[model samples]
Target: MSDNKKLSYCFDVDGANFTSAGEASVKVKKRLREAGFDPETIRRVSIAMYEGEINMVIHAGGGKAEVVIEEDRIVIILTDEGPGIADIDQAMQEGFSTAPDNIRSLGFGAGMGLPNMKRYTDEMVIDSRLGKGTKITMTVYV
Candidate 1:
């Protein structure tokens, strides 16, 4: 079913700031909570979005994230103009990471970002082109 209702928010991810990662997701989560969404739903959406935000910062050198909240579901779209994913299959696998060692030192690059985002969301779509960019859209039912 298509949702006629939609809520959209835009955020900028900072690639150079590791500590600033997930800030967007945190804001989204707070808004969702204040809107009276259940804790479980809030957690799921926040976690998935947070991971996507982190990926954009690390692999894509930042990006734009759009969140659409409908009556029955929430849709998150993350777009980046950095290096694209070479192998989506491999990247989707848990424990596989292409992040640099420096990134690993920051507590990321565990290779679970994509996998975790998929696991938490009901639907996930990835559109990527080498040397061009990547777009990830994920959805979760309320």
Candidate 2:
């Protein structure tokens, strides 16, 4: 790939389908591998994006996921129109989860999503509104 070239991808996340939760991240991981990114970089991006995608599905009822591959870093943006996070600080705590019991029974919703996302990425930012939605941008340096 040319030094100036950038690869971008967009996907629609289906919140209603638990089976498809990690689809976007899986696709991203494949793309990163094909693009020759280092395994560690690809791993971090995949994990961070996967956590974000799950959050979008469980909290917002689905949303959009976008990935941008630049020369020095990878960017993952997740946007959802569900109820926004009311307490970002609390949510960042490792075991703090608001996931419903039904979702918990499915083996997810352990409340580690945000914390894991933050832990795996070099940078993470969350923009949320009380009744509107949330937008999370994460970057992993190559």
Specify the highest-TM-score model's number: 2
Model 1 residue 56 distance off true place after TM-score fit, in angstroms: 0.9
Prediction 1 global C-alpha lDDT: 0.92
Q: How many backbone clashes does candidate 1 have?
A: 0
RMSD value for candidate 2: 1.2
The residue ranges of model 1 lying beyond 4 angstroms of the native Cα positions read 1-4
Model 2: per-residue Cα lDDT over 1-142, one tens digit each: 5567888999999989988899999999999999999899899999999989888888899999999999898999999999999999999999999999998998889989999999999999999998999999999888
Please identify model 2 stretches exceeding 4 Å from their true place: 1-3
Q: What TM-score does candidate 2 get on C-alpha atoms?
A: 0.96
Residue by residue across 1-142, what tens digits does model 1's lDDT show?
2466667889999988889898999999998998788999999999999999999888888999998888889999999998999999999999999999998998899999999999999999999999999999999999
Candidate 2, residue 2: lDDT:
52
Which lDDT value does model 2 have at 84? 99
